[model samples]
Target chain A: MQKNIAQGNLIPFVSVQQMVALIDSLGVEAFMTELAGYIEEDFKQWSLFDKSPRFASHSEVGVIELMPTSNGKAFSFKYVNGHPGNTRHGLQTVTAFGVLADVDTGYPVLLSEMTLLTALRTAATSALMAKYLAPEGADTMAMIGNGSQSEFQALAFKAMLGIRSLRLYDIEPAASRKLQRNLQDRGFDIVVCDSAQAAVEGARIITTCTADKRNATILTEQMVGSGVYINAIGGDCPGKTELDPLLLHRARVFVEYEPQTRIEGEIQQLAADFPVTEMWRVISGQADGRRAQDELLVFDGVGFAVEDFSALRYVYEKLSDNQGYDKLDMIADPDDPRDLFGMYLRLAPSRKGEAA
Target chain B: MQKNIAQGNLIPFVSVQQMVALIDSLGVEAFMTELAGYIEEDFKQWSLFDKSPRFASHSEVGVIELMPTSNGKAFSFKYVNGHPGNTRHGLQTVTAFGVLADVDTGYPVLLSEMTLLTALRTAATSALMAKYLAPEGADTMAMIGNGSQSEFQALAFKAMLGIRSLRLYDIEPAASRKLQRNLQDRGFDIVVCDSAQAAVEGARIITTCTADKRNATILTEQMVGSGVYINAIGGDCPGKTELDPLLLHRARVFVEYEPQTRIEGEIQQLAADFPVTEMWRVISGQADGRRAQDELLVFDGVGFAVEDFSALRYVYEKLSDNQGYDKLDMIADPDDPRDLFGMYLRLAPSRKGEAA
Candidate 1:
């Protein structure tokens, strides 16, 4: 049982752009479809995982969190940060990286730039919920927040659910214009809306992805009609939320990991005993999904580690054939482990300079 | 305020041997003295820190963890792994790395290889504790667990406290021999003992750093004298402990952080209401250190994130003036801030296929 990272070997390190290209080459639709399958499968055997709520460190400016999860065979962890006011400083709201390792050996097999992968997985998770919760052939989606993550969600829906028409709205109209322009030749019909109300007017799915870190009610209970799937993406921290309490109460709420969702999801505003279904149950066929055509279902997305684990797995496979990764010498190897001092002297210059 | 990490455009990674060289260049004694002062300063404003117990992913072979801490001015984190069984695999039992960043900008100012730094920091912490807990003229110490970290613990005590004699013991005789051989010319009088009893005989301080992830009775209550200071290092993680519960009951235990120690330190064996003082309290003069010369003081060392934070800060200052570091485009810098997709086109072409 003496497992190891192996001698004279390197772990796969994928850059953000390399991963974006890898995922793009994999195709957003195919990736989303495959990613959903991995999430669905992991969720089915959920009892095998050792789970814990994310460990978060918050400051006045932003938050940095570490989310770790392990299935019996492998372990994964993501180091992520969210800074809502960051864009004002000319930085992205989120920046991240992660490592996946062998459960037995404790050697990182995949060290990846997860900034872009996070966007892919978040969108993938949303589309995954739509696959199980949306009505048959649901095509039109009203995207309320059109920022950096907007195009990702748009493309995921377009590729996975065959979403054809997108009615987009944002606090800044330029964001909507950018989303529309990016998908111009991609064959999806797009419409720019004046407000959130106009965006959700006749859409089958309404996605509220605003980046406000406050208790702002972007979607009222009345605004969210029946038979609509709402992907609430931006309200991920405490004191930050999107859906009105009434809307949360009315919708058939589904969550990735309940204890985490209770603290960081839209349900953070609600009572602890607030009834909600774990998404895995629905995907595993053990629980009902979209009970009625007019049932308003809320997929409260604070984002989860399992999705990132799947994303890491997805990109690891893609980097196998690509020629663009840097091999980092992260771990040390010695002929004799007990002679670390000797190893150090041989590897680095002597502690004493000159001929001493 | 939006803080950006893009302007400097340097990755600045430090390898283990490089960090050792950096510390050596700065003078080990001077570095240790400065680090101790920094640790003391941070401890004075301890309430401002957001601290938590490390998140560990454990398996039969080894354990990997993420230890994160943040003050208002800065954020720091360490990625470390321990596998006592790794000796057979030709790797050190503990391997680690970490990053220190500005709180406002969220940019990593230093990403260091802490495999050796961890050992350095741990020894520095112990030496700092010895300054407060050990009597004014402490001379000899029993160095239990003669592994990779032993020589470091030995040297730090020699450099910082002017300890003149040493006694070493390990389960593996060869390890003890290696430690003895390495420190032969290092100023301290080294003695290799056959048994733990032989090592602790007539010693002023007892340092138990055995690496078994079990409740091993490395030092029993009978083995410890009333006035002897105990530097308990290797007992970390939930079921892993070095001392017996009886020892904790008698010793005036000083922990790094109470919440974290309650889970991973010798205090884990105590009741939930167990009274233990944070080491920072003693450092800040808020709590008494060594009430009586005969009082037993235990530095229940699981290693704190804040110590790593201080260590990273010290090394960052040491290396900031140096010229050897690789600059990585780990962060996304979109010109429009709205068009992250546009940055890839501007990224550097493959340094590959270039005449290296």
Candidate 2:
């Protein structure tokens, strides 16, 4: 039987292929740059957002979390999972999808694959923080882990902060080689270092993103120089950290949301009352970013819902022309709202046969 | 450019059309009867599931909520919204979609439209409760507020408890007429009544399901008779209720989840320490369902996540043959888990041109 669904029932869905095609039309660097602009705009209006820590379900091997946020007019949420052991089974360590809905009508307007969007938004957030905290004219970065996020980090910095020199290190040499090969033609001076210390020798910005589900000090106190910016992104869950406790004492930490960062970011190793600055305050000019050239600034990044919200909003705005999305009939709409049963009756096989 | 995504990246999606087709093939009454079986199976093992109050974001006009539950091996969450004023705009007051994921790998395996599924599950849950609490050989039911859920409730009772007669009433007369017309060919002896009091006369079961976002009582203490089962399903949010305080005190209440029911169910009108039995205990025989023929039993159901979990599990199991689903490329997968950038680079327009 043929059925015609109402327009309100169709949700715009962006699949992985459509996401790739959209990014291809707009170069990756430009997309991140544009996405960063959206993040910045939302951060400027930070106080308007309703923020809460993600609801996470932990298992023996992994975690599934729902991060939700809204700004009175619109609501957005991301469903994400992190499983460090998934790579052994040929699966991504992180996978995500998100939805943007109108708060007034309580209807979802857009749905998109957020695995790639998460990577892009994470990198954009890192670069946005570095824009305020990094030293003057810093052009070199030390990437301590070369995994799924390494190339995005490099390109975002290049697009936002003009960082063109890189030093990379990973536990697996193949990972670093993979990163080099991916960025070979992206216009950068690259060096593959054997150790984290060697990677940070002359760089003014150091980014640590490792994939172990344990506490590992990839950067020690002595390895971090004065006046350098530290972007820590991989220590996102409890008991999963990447910085030395001593290093946190030396740096002035800034976080996306303090309540969440205290439990999931690098600062999870520190005391509950450890003082930190919220990045929104910095972006809104309520707090200082870098006080002195010799001062250390650490952006304790654990990823936040607002960043995903910004990414979802960006994709939703870009979907106006309907070029990068498919219409998904995901809602049940009857001619009369109270007649859902009548609608179903019309679709019944016996009813269809009778109508024929 | 053509890219081959791994099997793990594709999630099986059941759209509204597919859901209708699946129900048509199975027949609605049989479908709900089988779904009630699944709900019973899960309720029997209720202690093993992770239960949490739904996360709600309330606005002036509506509310959006996320209800999540898991049983160690699998996880499920439903995104639903409620807007009482949506009908005036030709929209459903309730719309939902859900996800089922494998906890072992933290990957979603199934996504389905849950608007229709929610109606079916709610009806199944009510009828499942009636199987234990309704007076013996109860064949007649009084259905108050014949909205989207009225026909489903009638059919589920017919399928599960052999209730062949229904007395329906609604403030909007058109709603009752619509429900009667929908179930006219389904072998039900239905009477569309003008008043709730008149509808409950001579009925052994009374079901109250209205769509007002207020504390208005649809059933009074004097109207309800002893030895009857009361299924309260629509008083499902804070500050919204359907039963009078006197009526709640007169009935022995059973709830899906006590902590949640105290906040969102008909019992929300009573004191915080009001006594209630959990339905799982009743189903497992830990608590008595109906002690005497004259004892009043009320199933104060403010739909729980476990019921939705059961529905998601049911659909996931039915998708094995892939007849009622579409493959959605919603995850980003790289040949090497760490080489997501390489995967994106291959999809670059310049790279596609070069390959050509």
Instruction: Identify the candidate with maximal lDDT.
Output: 2
Q: Find the 10 residues in a row with the least total lDDT in model 1 chain A.
A: A1-10
Residues A5-46, candidate 1: write the lDDT tens digits.
323235556765666566556665687777777777777888
Interface RMSD of each candidate, angstroms, one decimal: 4.0, 1.9
> How far off is residue B32 in model 1, in Å?
3.5
Docking quality tier of candidate 1? acceptable
Residues B190-212 of candidate 2: C-alpha lDDT, one tens digit per residue: 98898999999999999999987
- Over the full model, what C-alpha lDDT does candidate 1 score relative to the true structure? 0.77
Interface RMSD of 2: 1.9
lDDT of 1 by residue, B223-278 (tens): 87777889998887778788878888888888888888888887888898878888
DockQ of each: 0.36, 0.67
What DockQ score does model 1 reach against the true complex? 0.36
